[model samples]
Target: MLAIAEYVVRGALSGAIYALLAVPMSLMFVTVRTIDFAVGAYALIAAAVCWSVGGALGLAAGLGAAMACAAFMAIIFLALKRLGCEDHIIYALASFGLATALASLVLWWWGTQAFVRDAFSDPWSVGGIRLAPQGVINFALILLLVGALHLLIQHTSLGRMMRAAAANQTGAALASIPVQGIQVGTYLAGGLLGGLAGLLVLYSAGLDFTAPLGLTLSGFGAAIIFGIGSPLRGFFGGLAMGIAQALAAGYASAMVAGMVPFLFVLLVLTTSRFGEEALAGGRP
Candidate 1:
């Protein structure tokens, strides 16, 4: 029981990073009706850059690289829009292509080396359960950032604009809202959040060049597990996924542990009305 408790605690902390990654997915889905499949690529690039450079400047450089990649995605998005591409699947595919390209770029540039960094030398004891200081920091930072995002989405005029744009892009455009600009901003925000998640992961479990697709799928699972309608839901979903995976890792095979997120996604899609709504083009 004690061991299980520890797993749960650790899982929650790790899940916070997934929640951060999911935020951009939720925001972009709501605003643009598409998934930014390149989000994980953004994280991977950030980690790769940070690993190569090392130190505080590496962090900045990593984030900059991630955001630059996002800017490139934004340009692709805008170009697609300009070309009169209205299919959300096309957007998703485009992002997937970008993700693949970025992964290849990382592999070509950095090889298959794993990106990792140790931020703390000791674990902190909290309520008799040992926890990594870095994990605690990650959890706290996620809480604050998620809270801020909730506030931004629910209270501010910018949030209102985002919601308006999501609810009806045509109407928002008629209302003189810069829908494209808002979408571009959302992409940039995705980059920031994805890059931050990469840094957190680098300092936690580490990852390799092959991690981008897995990371993207994990974030997507987290985003949709509780319905991608809100960031708060995505936050909880991430925690749920983390806990499930942690429990599996503790008691089951490693392969089973890895399959947890995908299983959750499958379960959600089969049992929830959210999947139906998404397919029918209804707002989640």
Candidate 2:
């Protein structure tokens, strides 16, 4: 029973990290109807910067790099919007190209070597289960993010405007809400969050160029499993995925754990007719 409990706790922590990574992607999908393939790349950039610089300066540099990447994405996407490229496919292609470019850049600059953050030399432990300080930090940040999102969505005018724009872009614009500004703001915030997730990932597992694709896939799987429209649902979905993977790795094999996300993605795709209909404000 204790072993089971340990696995459950470990899985939940992993899920929290997955949820954190998924939130930014989910937010962007709902708000701007754009899938940012570069989201994971943004995280990679932050982590690489953090590793190169170290300490507080590294942290700030990492965040700044993420913000800059976000700004660049916003500029390109907003330009696409202005240039009559309204199709989501175009935006997706643009994001994919940007992500590829960024990955190449990071590879050239940072090399393909992997490194972990090692935040705590002595991680906290209880009942034979060890917990990294970085994991605790990740959980705390997830809670803070969820709380802030809830407050923004429930208690603020900006939240209302965001909802309005998400529900019906034309109606929101007709209502005179700053729809474009809201989307731009969402992109910026998503970028920042994406960067933070990257830092957390670095702390937990280290990173290489390949990390971006895995992170991106995991984020999408989590968000899609719960229907991307709801951040809270996505969070829980991520938690579930993490738990399953942990259990698989603990009882089965590490190879199985690595494949769990792909399996989950396929399960959702084959089982649900929705296929991310939540993006259209529909529930999964």
What CA RMSD would you report for each candidate?
A: 1.8, 2.2
- Candidate 2 C-alpha lDDT tens digits along 120-201: 7888886788888788788888978876885776568988888788778999999999999998898888778888888998
Residue 142 of model 2, lDDT score: 91
Evaluate model 1: give its TM-score. Answer: 0.94
Q: What overall lDDT goes with each candidate model? A: 0.89, 0.81
lDDT of 2 at 167: 77
lDDT for model 2 comes to 0.81
Of the candidates shown, which would achieve the greatest lDDT relative to the real structure?
1
Global lDDT for candidate 1?
0.89
Residue 263 in candidate 2 has what lDDT?
A: 81
In candidate 1, position 197 carries an lDDT of 91
Give the distance in Å from residue 209's predicted Cα in candidate 2 to where it truly belongs. 1.7
